[model samples]
Target: MSDVWTWPARIGVLLGAGLFLALLVPILVIQIRRYGTTSPARLLGAAALAVYGTALVAYTLLPLPSGDLAAWCAEYGYPTVQLRPGQIFADIRERTAGLPLGAVVRDISVLQGVFNVVLFVPWGILVRRYLGWGLLASAASALGASLLIEVVQATGVFGLIPCSYRLADVDDLVTNTVGGVLGALIAPWVLRWMPRAKTLAATRGEPRPVTVWRRWLGMAVDAVAYTTLSGLLAMAWGLVGYLGTGQVPPDTVPLWLFASVLSWVVVFVLPLATGTGESLGQRTVWLAVVPDVSRVADGGVGLSWSARLRRGLAGGALWGLLQVLSDAATMFDVGALASASNLASWFAAVLVVAVPFTAGKRGLSGRAAPYRLADAREGAGALSTHR
Candidate 1:
């Protein structure tokens, strides 16, 4: 038990788990990009599978007993392979024939045999549950897994290490296969608690009309984009300053000022530059702004260059002011102001949703201007004007 639960081993497991989880981020991002949404059940299932695989791989290969390959090679010879059938059973019978029950139960070899069988049982369960494999399939998979381990041990980890340090036993293959078959046989009972595969697939809910939830999803994407863009820009700026001055760059501009500029660029200037009122969030949600039908006849359909500039400047100024205030409060350690700013931000976010019901389907910004929010008329990311 002490050998199994060492701190180094625990740390290895943790690092493996984290590595698996970190890898999932890009996979999830890809899934979201392709599907325009994610399924919680699929994500959770994939994450769980990754964790198990990582742990298994770590346990099988990490923390090599011998570090100095040359010294290990000099000391240890190639391991003898055990391929004879029933050899393990014969040994077990000879060792336990006259032993008392307690002694047999306490035997380390007996415990190890049991552990080998138990180790592959989860594989069978997972195969049946996640992959929907049948009994033969699970058993075959288990046999393959056992064969791979044996091959690795036989080849000295594919010649990466010095010599074969672990035993390659045929009994392990038999026991593992048996364990997997047994697990498959009992999968119905064991996996009863888990959601069905069909249910998991269905959890990716149908796409509805662009509502508050969809809008919120778009905003979430925008938030990610903003943070990523800001970080990249900051790094680039720092590098440029360092190259020019031959010293580490310092923040010459105040945090509030920097945040204000970033907010204007991210929220207003860039969106207007697209020649659409849709910010990144609105574009992702397939929303657009168009002149209200009632106001289009009143010279609201087309605005002069000066009017467009005023609208962009006004929107940018408001966003910049909010961003600056938030940054200032955070920098000054004003917790109350920071909290208030966060609340205010949420309130402003909800304004679009609330205004639709209260102000006749016009967003806060749209109503103030000459536009209203309109979703894509056609399916699959086609945006059309409200008019």
Candidate 2:
């Protein structure tokens, strides 16, 4: 009995963790783009949904035959389909006949039916409350999803497996759907504290105050994006080289150099050339670099391509140079330069953390450039007013 629950739980947790990690960046990007900010409740709900999804799959379709599929199917001589509804009630009654109420409730058949219903309750709550779907739509969706799961089971995983390993019962469909409808009915109370998508979208374009934390978040995104791009490029080059030449390259200097250049083009050059004056990460997090007009007699207007490029270079050059040197040292096995690069990288991090505490909240880069970071939506409005 413990094995019945433990195996599925373990599988679900492991798969769900992997799925969450894969979706983290995309989830952040989507939240910022759609709502202009992140919500802890929404992120937690998303994580819960991922876990529930994997758990559902694990429960419904796991414990597949290991070997001797035909023999296993023959040994498990249960009906693949149970079309008659209310069979669950009959089974429960037969199994728990003349037993005490407590014993009856604890009966295996009764628990099975209850578990199926409980498993789908979250589906209804998430669909109806989090997604803001109508009750009818949520209920229909739950029924459809339950039907699909049963169908897949009855069809032996869409004919991949030789035969159905579990019963596909009409009773399960009814119970699951009922659970979904019940959940939808109570979702408003359950998720009273959660922000609705509609509410978030309504204020998405409104200007938000620039904060040190927001600045750090944008920078973190930039670092992660740059590192991921460089790593992927290097891996692709290595893969291609291995396929064509039939040997893995011994030296990685060429690959790292090529990757660094391409990543720079993407992370730095593209934003400036497009006149957005924001890195990919900044744009994703709803931040932008705008001209500082505090000293000008007349306020500054929008930045030209050349002006934007100059500002970007000034703000990013030191850290970018350090990154390049680090890559070079790594590729060439230059121990001294690697150590220097590591120290510089730490120093750069300290500056990023410390600068926000200083007057004007300008980091090392911001002080060097004629521009400062602003919320993209707010910055756009400010720029337009000046124009």
Best-matching candidate per TM-score: 2
Per-model lDDT: 0.62, 0.77
lDDT by residue for model 1 (41-136), tens: 556656666665665555555545567787876676455888897777778788899999999987767876886787677788888876778888
Predicted candidate 2 versus true structure: per-residue lDDT over 1-387, tens digit per residue = 678977887877889888987787778777878998887889887887788889888998886666887788788825559999999988987899999999998888988899988988999999998889999999999999999998888877887767877789899899999999998999999999999988998899987777776666666676677778888988888899999999887656677668876786787677656765677767778777667676333575555655665556554434555676788787888876777577657866776776677545556656655566677776556755532
Off by over 4 Å in 2: 1-3, 6-22, 67-71, 77-79, 227-260, 273-276, 294-348, 379-387
Number of the top lDDT candidate: 2
TM-score of each candidate structure, all chains considered together: 0.57, 0.79
lDDT of 1 at 67: 74
Worst 10 residues of 2 by lDDT: 312-321
Local error of candidate 1 at residue 256 (angstroms): 26
